[model samples]
Target: MTKNETDERRAAMALLAAATARELDSAWTAWPERPAVEDLRKAACGLVMVRGRIGGDGAPFNLGEATVTRAAVRLSTGHIGHAYLLGRAPERARLAAIFDALWQDVSARPRVDTELLAPVRARLAAEAAKAVAEAAATRVEFFTVTRGDNQEAAS
Candidate 1:
């Protein structure tokens, strides 16, 4: 895949991974047609070593371990999709993988975006905006007025 394809795939996968199980299942239920999907890798849960960098620029270190579930699916059209998500929601992982493969098809991409990605993107955007607004509402500005005597002394 080209760089753009890789980027788009990455973004689609992230959006899928962010989706709640109910949302994903609903999207699957709304599919106009079901393409045969083969499980390249069955959904499984495991632990991964979480790593972090101090201030995002310092040396990397192991933060902790997190539970992650992963799955891979191959569509009839030959596209393969993979997913790794936090927590043990195997069904969600499988659905996400299936959607990922579906999203690979240029013709199916628009439908996938509308049925799954677009709504999720809008909801997430609104949520983020609400959070920002809430934080902004609590913002405080600090300022000082110079004393007349101090101004005179400086002059």
Candidate 2:
């Protein structure tokens, strides 16, 4: 595949992996049955160190650890898929992997995109917007008053 296509596919897979279990379950219920998927690697959970930079460009530091689950599957047609998700939702990881594999199939791509990924994407976007609005509602703006001496006033 071309670079752009590869990037797009990667982005789609990332979205699938990041989806919540409820979102995935809803999309899965709407999807049609397909060929059986063989587990290339069963879902497993582990801890990974979360890292951060001082100012996003400074030295990196360990923020903490986070639980992560990962799974791999191969469709009957030989397309392979994998997913890594936060927390211990094994089933969610597996389902995400399956969708990733389905997305690679040309015949299934359109259906998977429209039926599965699109709705989840929309829901996620709406939730994010709602969260942003809620946060904005609670926002407190601060202002500083200058002294007559052209110096900043201590508040």
Candidate 3:
């Protein structure tokens, strides 16, 4: 896949991670007909070593281990998709993998992008904006004044 495809898939996965159970269920329900999906790798939870850097480009180090659930699904049409969710949400990981496979299809991309991703994107954006506004509301600014000889003499 090209860089664009990789980026698009990454963004789709990110949005899928934020999708609610209701949203995923609704997406599945709304489909006119469901394709046969095979679990190449059933949803399973495991620990993965988290890596971090002193700075973004600094040397990498193992931060710690995090619980991650991952799954892989293959559409009847032969498209394979995989997902790794942050927590042990089997249902979410399974649904996300299925959606990832669906998004790969040219015909199904529109529906997946609209019905699932759009709502999640909107919700996340709203949440981020609210957080920024809340933080701004409580924001403080500090400044230091320089004392001059004249001020000292006056005192």
Q: Would you list the C-alpha lDDT of every candidate in the order shown?
A: 0.93, 0.88, 0.89
lDDT of 1: 0.93
- Which digits, one per residue and each the tens of the lDDT, describe model 3 over residues 1-155? 89999999999998887787788888988886889999999999999999999787799999999998899999998889888888888888899999999999989999998899998999899999999999999988887565675676543
> What's the lDDT for residue 143 in model 2?
82
> With candidate 1 superimposed using the best TM-score fit, by how many Å does residue 145's alpha carbon deviate from the native?
6.6
* Residue 132's lDDT in candidate 3: 97
Q: List runs of model 2 lying over 4 Å from the truth.
A: 141-155
Q: What is the lDDT of residue 61 in candidate 2?
A: 99
TM-score of 2: 0.83
Q: Cα lDDT for residue 90, model 2? A: 93
TM-score of 3: 0.87
| Model 3 CA deviation exceeding 4 Å by range | 55-57, 143-155
lDDT of model 1, residue 54: 91
Give TM-scores for every candidate, taking all chains together and pairing residue i with residue i: 0.89, 0.83, 0.87
Tell me the spans in candidate 1 whose CA falls farther than 4 Å from its real position: 145-155
Residue 24 displacement (Å), model 3: 1.2
lDDT measured at residue 85 in model 2 versus the true structure, 0 to 100: 82
Better of 2 and 3 by lDDT: 3
Ranking by TM-score: 1, 3, 2
